[model samples]
Target: MINGVTQLEILDFSHNRISNDGAIALAKLISWHKSLQELKLCNNYIGSLGIEGISFALARSPALAHLDLRLNSYVGDEGGIFLCSALSQNTKLKSLFLAACGLGSKAGKFVGEMFKVNSTLLEMDLSNNDLTEESGELLNQGLIKNFKLQKLDLRMTNVSQAWEFAINEQLARNIANSTRNNINSNSQPNMKTIEES
Candidate 1:
């Protein structure tokens, strides 16, 4: 019951000192609002419990597209895993920001798994985490299968340069192939028209 605000689409509480209780309240609000598309909770003090609550709510929110949880240092690997599991069920989510959220290699693996099944996500930011080369390899395995992801930010993580280069190359190749297909499809009608004339 947020008064008459039933159609709220975007909720940004960045830089707020919202703790676990506040996160639970926000989660309830999100569950009630079916039109909410984006939620930003960056720099909050939400911990693993808070994240679990939020994840539960997000799992049911069909219209939420973007979720920003950056700089919530208390949400460690466990929280990351929980969020990833929830993301697997959320089909409308497109962008996720988990920068500096104390994520490590284990969480990275879960993220990779989520990507394999979650096809709607397009942008992801995992900067300033504790990821390692192993994590990068797991992520690469998922990226190879996921064609919808268009933007990825891994700055300040422990992922190696080689891995980054490979990911970039793959993305570029996908783009080039898609462009070529589009060009060929578009030219077919014109060629037919020219021949007919």
Candidate 2:
């Protein structure tokens, strides 16, 4: 059922004992399937090598959009760097879920850098990860630089009060800006419609 299926649209192998080898096997299959969109391998034993394989595979995949690798134990700061590097070139991906993936300050720094340049990314879920204050600060700076991101989830990651306050302010400003834009857009009516009315 699995090995014979080459055109799978979604594959979820989360909470399994599969190691890097298994992850690599799945990643390799991406080359054969162009229809694969959402892939979830969360809570697996796949570590750095597996992540690298996936990163490499994503480099060539144009149809893949949403990827969920939450709770994977092998992805540290270095793996994060590689993943973000791959994401930099992948413009088709809109949503990325990497919650509780053991991201440290180093990884978070790279993630922050990724956000600074990747404008195609709309939503990112990094909740329950081990991101520290330093990483949070870096991400805050990254957020300030990039305006294309719509939502960023950092729930239960030990974010400091100061950082929380700052992020709150940023969210408030974002809401105000969005509201202003909507009001301005709605205020303008079609001249033809007005005349006809």
Candidate 3:
């Protein structure tokens, strides 16, 4: 399971009764840990400044696989933008969980931009935000050239039905393309096996 990343291999800080300042300070430590791969800060009441601190710290790392920040309702669009900007250049993260973090329509453009260049991220959860149809389309547009992301959850948002469907369809297409590519790459038989045959 994914725990709130505290820059340890798997440090879970969810519902730990940690103070906001303390959490922010701990989050800032992410910049120094090269082996740290996952961070989760779910339901921590972290504000935008805390998020900015964490984002800045996280941006310095070359790779991290998972980050869960669910239920930090105060990390609004500003926080989202900070995190997305930090993540845009990272290509090693595979899953991100941001459910109920209050990322509204304003964060959509940056989130979409992240999708455009990130080739390793595979899943994301943005449920319960007040995102609109336009935001959904922006995200979809970013996915047009991306074939790495396979799952995107937008539940409880205000995205229109049509746009939601389109986004899902695009995700499905990406999954299919990735699967096909993987199969094709692996289908090449080993030369030694061919010689034995």
Better of 1 and 3 by TM-score: 3
- Of 2 and 3, the candidate ahead on lDDT is 3
What lDDT would each prediction earn against the true structure? Answer: 0.87, 0.79, 0.82
Clashes of 2: 1
In Å, residue 158's CA in model 2 sits off its true spot by 2.5
Residue range 128-151, candidate 1, lDDT tens digits: 999888888888888888777777
Write out the backbone clash pairs for model 2.
47-74
Q: Model 2, range 25-115, lDDT digits (tens) per residue?
A: 8887764567788888888877888889988988777577788888885787777888889877777777888887777888888888887
Candidate 2 segments exceeding 4 Å error: 1-7, 168-197
User: Would you give me the overall lDDT of model 3?
Assistant: 0.82
What are the per-model C-alpha RMSD values against the true structure?
3.7, 3.6, 3.6
